[model samples]
Structures are given as structure tokens and as C-alpha cells.
Target: MARFGSARFTTVQPGVKINNQPRPAPRTRAGGSLVAFAASAVVLLLLLIFILQNGQRTDVHFFGAQGQLPMGVALLLAAVFGVLLVTIQATMRRIIQLRLLTGRRRTPYTSTITRPDPADADPGADVPEGRKS
Candidate 1:
């Protein structure tokens, strides 16, 4: 359907081309990496400062020697402990996966399923007709 006007043809004219210079050199990937690292460092510093300002102190004992520890140190130790715990859990999970892959464990549903005998069937009944029972 014609909406604006009747269909018409005109002489084609090539538009002028602007500067086609290649784009300037992009910032190095290392610069972006450094920015991300700096941002993470800032966040870590903020977290540390917040914890030091708001947290309390405690004592830790190891090999019978007890010493008072700052809240920040304790928090750091706790974080390290949590990382170790996660590492251990991941290791155990990997070990289990490897064991299963190596055939050390059987899947739960490997065996065939068996149904109970029919209600009208008998275990030791004799043949009833010419057809084999």
C-alpha cells in the first residue's frame, strides 16, 4: 500500500566518506587488570577497617601456649580456617567422584527390578491345559 507517496526512482548519489583512520590503540589488558585489582584491594581494606572498628578481641591457644589475639587477626585466621574447610570438603568430593568414576562404587539402581507374582498365580501349580503353564 502507498502511505507517504507514489513509488518513485531517483538518480543514486554516493555519499561523501569521512576520515577512515583506524581507531587509536586500546588500553592494555594489564591496565584493566590493575584497575580490578585496585578495586578489590579497596574493598578488602574497607572490610578490614570496618571489622577492626566494630569487632572485639579474643585469645587463641595452640600447643599449650595461649596468647591474646586482635580481632582482625582472629578474623583473618577464621577466614583461613574456613578456606581450609572448604578445600577439604572439595577434596573429599573430588575423591568421591573419582572413586565413582573408577568403578569403586555401584549406582543405586544398577540391578534389574523384580515385581511380585500375580495374585492368581501359584508357585508350584501343575500345568492346567495343553498350553505350557
Candidate 2:
């Protein structure tokens, strides 16, 4: 990890270029954030292009409702609604499980572990096998 001509780390090793500072550490969080940001930007750009390209309005009808929406927007709304439905269903399932768990009677905790007998403290002592030995 030595860098050329840095006098600070000359004593660290023999006749090679010495680097005073420690080796650079990878910035995982920053790099991850940057990658995520780039991905998000790309996705946003693509979405914008898709919306612009599908600007033509189309009639939309849903359970006693009617409206006009751009194709891209309508599709996006449908996808969002689908995700919401799944999320709500999962939430309800978890709630039901929690309620069931709460309603059930739980056995009171009992310690099966008892203190070691003072007689059994010395391993070298000759003794009969005790129940919990």
C-alpha cells in the first residue's frame, strides 16, 4: 500500500516508496447511495419518457367510477393499487396471527435449572450419580 516518494512511511519498509497515510478504505454507504441514485435517475428518466410517449388520454372505468387518464398514468395507478392490495392483505394476515397468539394461554415459565449441590462441587470426590448430575 506504499505510494511513491512519501517520506512519512520510509521507516515502514526497505528501499521502496513510502506512503505516510493509511490505505484508502472503500466508502460503501456513499458508493451504494451513488449507485442507487444513478439507478433511480435512470428509472425516473425512463418513466418520464414513457409518460410523454403515452400522452394520449384513454377512458377508464372502475367499480362505479369513470374517468379519462393517460395510458402510462392509468397503468401506473393500476400497479400501485395492486401493490396496495397485496400489502393490506399481508397486514390483515399478520394482525390475525398476532390476535390468535395473544388469545392463547401461555404456560408460566418454570426453571428446570437448579443450583448445583455443594456436595457435587468437587469433581474429584467419589459420589453416587445424582438425578441432575
Candidate 3:
């Protein structure tokens, strides 16, 4: 066999589309995550700007605790505490639900899976050692 001086390479064909129609690109988890991250970053930037703009200091009093904090910071803290309370409540509810589920699983009446007693199992029914039916 002799080699040709000019080499021709075959082009890779693109994938065939369904019904020969053009379809939009599919959404990807990374793409969605990137968008969410960008949105969160923008929100954080806006919050930062808001906090900076409201630079006035205010007195904060809570259950015998007194402190001075920026007005924006105080409001942000209040919102954070409120969110924490809801999170705690939801967490407690989930914990209680899990506990109840576990308790129910342990209860004899609630359990559906049953096993035969080992003592009730017969070694032989048709014949026995040194004996025949």
C-alpha cells in the first residue's frame, strides 16, 4: 500500500434531532445554581448598600440587654431572629414527627412484618431418625 501525499479527513457528523426539528438547549443543574448564586449575590449587594445608606445608630433593648446598633443593622437582626424562630419551630416539628414515626415502628400493632418463632419450626414431618412413618 502506498500513502497519498494529500490526506482527506472525514468530518464528524452532528447528532440527529428528533423529527428533524431544532430544540432549545436543556437547562442544567450547574446553570441553575449559577443563576441562583448570582441572584443571591445581587441581593446581598443591595442589602449592603441599604445598610450603608442607613448609618444612623439606635438603642436596642432586649430582655435586660441593652446595646447601640445601626438602624439598618437592628432591623436586619430583627428579621434574622424572626427567621431563626421559624426555623427552630419547623426543626422541632420535624424532630417530633420523626420521633413519633420511630415510636410507631417500635409498637407491635403498627409493625406489619412478622417472623415465625424458631421453636414452632418442625425438624421433620414425614420421617424421623431411627423411625419411619
Best by lDDT: 3
- Per-residue lDDT of candidate 3, residues 3-77 (tens digit): 677576668766567788755568999999999999999999998998998889999999999999998899889
Better of 1 and 2 by lDDT: 2
- Give a tens-digit lDDT track for model 2, residues 4-83: 88665544443333386655645798899999999999998998898889989999999989999999999889988999
When sorted by TM-score, best at the front, the candidate numbers are 3, 2, 1
- Model 1 residue runs over 4 Å out of place are 1-35, 54-57, 104-133
Please give the ranking of all candidate structures by lDDT, highest first, separated by commas: 3, 2, 1
Query: Which regions of candidate 3 are displaced past 4 Å?
Result: 1-21, 109-133
Residue 83, candidate 2: Cα error in Å is 1.4
Q: What global local distance difference test value does model 3 have? A: 0.87
In order of listing, the candidates' clash counts read 0, 0, 0
Q: Model 2 Cα displacement at 41 (Å)?
A: 1.7
lDDT of 1 by residue, 1-133 (tens): 5456668756765555458654454699998999999999998898788678846668888779888887777777878899999999999999999987878565566778888678767754666567554
lDDT (CA) for every model shown?
0.79, 0.84, 0.87
Candidate 2 deviant stretches above 4 angstroms: 1-24, 98-105, 108-133
Pairs with backbone N, CA or C atoms under 3 Å apart (clashes), candidate 1: none
TM-score of each: 0.43, 0.52, 0.65
